[model samples]
Target: MTGNARSEETLLLRSAVDRLKTALPRTWTLDLDLDPGRDGTVTAVAPDARLTIRTPSGASATFTIEVKRASRGSVRGALERLLLLSDGQPALVITDFANPALRKQCEELGIGYVDLTGWVFIRNDSAGIFVRTQGPARQAPLPDGRTTATKRLDGPGASKVVRALWDVTSTTGVRELAQRAGVSAGTVTKVLPALAAYGAVTRLRDGGVTDVDRRLLMERWTLDYKIYRTNPEVLWRLAPRGPDLAYADLLATDLGNDPTGRTIAYTGWLAATVSLPEGNYPVVPNTLLSIYSADPGALGDDLGLRTASPQTANVVLIRPRDETLLTGVPLPVPEPQIIADLMTMGGRYDELATQLSEATSVRTETP
Candidate 1:
């Protein structure tokens, strides 16, 4: 792991301990055993921290945990690494984000672990605790202090890179991968490091991408997109003078066919419910239209879009993160992006969000 990677893991360690303090049941007591001598440094290599949990009736167990920068794509290997330094004591594995699949392995093998996203599983002969809370929803790692802006991985370039890594089972160089993903080489250069910051991508000796934790990548992406990514979208509605599709087609044709405009996409009830069938979600008819556009006014003007009252709006115009969103999917925002965006809407959209999330969780690749 690189220095930044190590720092990221250490930060996650502190966060996990803090969450442990708050996540404990009122009837149970948990102590963060961060004593000076036992700061989880075992021999030359110590675990992240030592934790002790006690129930009111007096049962208690101490666990020294190993917090990885991220799960290294192998649950057994992670379990082994923790046990090696733990001297046979139970090992708890944690990552920057949780993997339910990994959590299942931990439970089956009697190992304990938690992902930053509120998924926790711990079991010992004396006590067992299982809880799932909403995970951290930050958009990206807090700026590393060296740069003014945080790394962003929500755009189309990122989608291309991430999808290639997730769907294509072969390895490719930066330039080749860029060609394959229909994105610029500069964009590939930009996205790889951002993914690496969270241990989502591993570079080859040739500085090419060799491995990617697609699930972890998406999980972290959602956390940041839901929490921090700027929504430059300016939502407005117009009572259509004609049919809703008439206006939608106008905007889609204008933006999608623009030879010299930003790459755009669409998401909202119509895109998710009608254009994309993966979500299988029921939506109100023509309730609203959302598009990924840098120049919505230009497109909206053709369709006679006007300022819609929040209560009576028939369309939503979103500012897109980047061009990568338009590459692979029929909708402006792809599945993961749409799912995360919908999650933030909170209402009937929330129901659709859940459906989209479940669908995307199983098959992230576009049909």
Candidate 2:
């Protein structure tokens, strides 16, 4: 065959091999051969087996298989070079033994190799066989039957201290907490406030500290336990959906009250108009809309409640006693004098809405 024709054939074989590499997993290897022969056949040989295909031009390609041992690194390097230099041509890797290290390296590198009984094949060229030797296997069972599954923990002294604090709080006294926690009293003293800030513990007036609240502690502990037990990637799927507005407000208030003392205020007008069926609308009917604010203190003052549009006046406060409509509980409207006072302070909703929208947008964009 002419040099040009051989090159073209090599390119075709490389393209075919590239497709094979993508289709097969790291465990499989491929070998190809193309040679002009008297009988015009192309043959590929893998470990323990060989296949032959008749060629249209009476030319034949033959492949010979050899077994070599290899380390994971060597096998991976060989595969990478083959894939890059072969121009997509399929080459073969021949190994004498199944080297676990080599297999691991191939898996890590996403390189493909085939293990055939006692030999391995990695393909990089259409015709040649390359052999590389590997070392003896170091196989031993783990003492505790446990594998290293996660990255190492790197924080300094904090986790140990936290665990100790947990034990102390779980029990009762500061001295016992200190001893069991394996830390000095001073360390405990310093960590107690930090723990309290995280709502992990509470400080008592009598110079003792304990867990802040049992329910809150238990809930957080449970969450932490689950996260530790499962993979971190799956934690979000197991988290709970909380009350939307109330949760947001609590988060905002907590951020504001931090050491920075930065007050984050939210002001937004939430207007909902329900259109009744034809003729079903009530004339001048009293409507009660429950309003909640992250900063309840700012609702009337900073929220600009007095300057709100008249349309917002439709919302009125309902007494808890009359909340159940079917019970015939008397409407708990305040006396006329109190209503007059509220009307005078109703216009602040718009200003509050503007502030809230801006604050919320800023908070949302923080990350």
Candidate 3:
């Protein structure tokens, strides 16, 4: 075994021993057979290890696992590399970086991952453990306005394409997708390649989407969704007094199911409550109200909402990307669009985004 692969396996073994000691019952012992591979490379061969858990009573269970270090910076590259690995056992991706988005990608790809920082999630028939610790900030490691701002997916129009890609539930080509999304052919042309580059969309040689990688799509979309086209104008409105339903009911009366206008219907959590499935979000809607308006300046008067300190602000007023966003989609807020918006919310929304994707996505085993 090469020194790098050998050393990497030793470290992974140590982690398995440590975590399994607690996971397994009392008086149970754990042993690992790690194969660093003939070439001392993680990808040279997939015959990595066979682990066994033996109890004091001689009840033993054995399973297979592969340990590999994640190549830094390029999640797409990491996934492509992982795909080349042998499928004999579940692969454990050990990296120093514990990026939630990357973790999501690993899950979507059906690959198990663990970061050196002690964040780990692995599963097998014999035993499974799920522990999430803070991983590195690789999820958005680059500074603002760097690579993402320049990408073709960084716009509202491209978002239309993304929505169609995820929500439509039918195979589509460029022209078909463009017409379905009501976007220009150029926008679809530009975004599809970008999506394909990340392994989010599996395209035929002729470029039809046979299947979409939901994890990759969510991870990539979250990276740039907020800054994509425009930052929504935010204002907080203090709640006077009422049930949450009463508050929403007032808006419903004015909007009347039209999600766009001087004061169009709300989108994020509020919209999810009124439109999408339950348990899609982690928490109930916060006191903050998100509203979209063409004439936001005049919005406060009618809704009894007013600009307040951001901390105290309860209303979030957004400028529409275009009325198409509100009217064109079947849902009050499309699933992909909601996931993008939640990604920027900076709370437990990332988890919520994952749940929403799993709830909406169609998962099939990768070839």
The candidate that achieves the highest lDDT relative to the unseen native structure: 1
| TM-score, prediction 2 | 0.19
lDDT of 1 by residue, 175-289 (tens): 8888877788888777766565455666664657766665556665655554124555565767565336754466555556666574457776655575345436465445666
RMSD of each: 6.9, 24.3, 9.7
TM-score per model over all chains? 0.60, 0.19, 0.55
Identify the superior model by TM-score, candidate 2 or candidate 3.
3
- Largest TM-score belongs to which candidate? 1
Checking candidate 3 for backbone clashes, the offending pairs are: 2-40, 98-135, 98-136, 236-313, 237-314, 237-315, 289-314, 289-316
Ranking by TM-score: 1, 3, 2
Q: The CA-based lDDT of model 2 is what?
A: 0.33
Candidate 2 lDDT over 1-367, as tens digits, reads 4887446535534543454355444544544544323344443422321223223333333333222232112343455654443334333433423445445554454333443222233332333333223332322222587421111111213333444443342435655666665556655555443334223455554435644443222222232222112211111110022223332443544533434322332211222112222333322222323232222234223322332233433322221211111122112122111121222223543233233333433543468
**Models ranked on lDDT:** 1, 3, 2
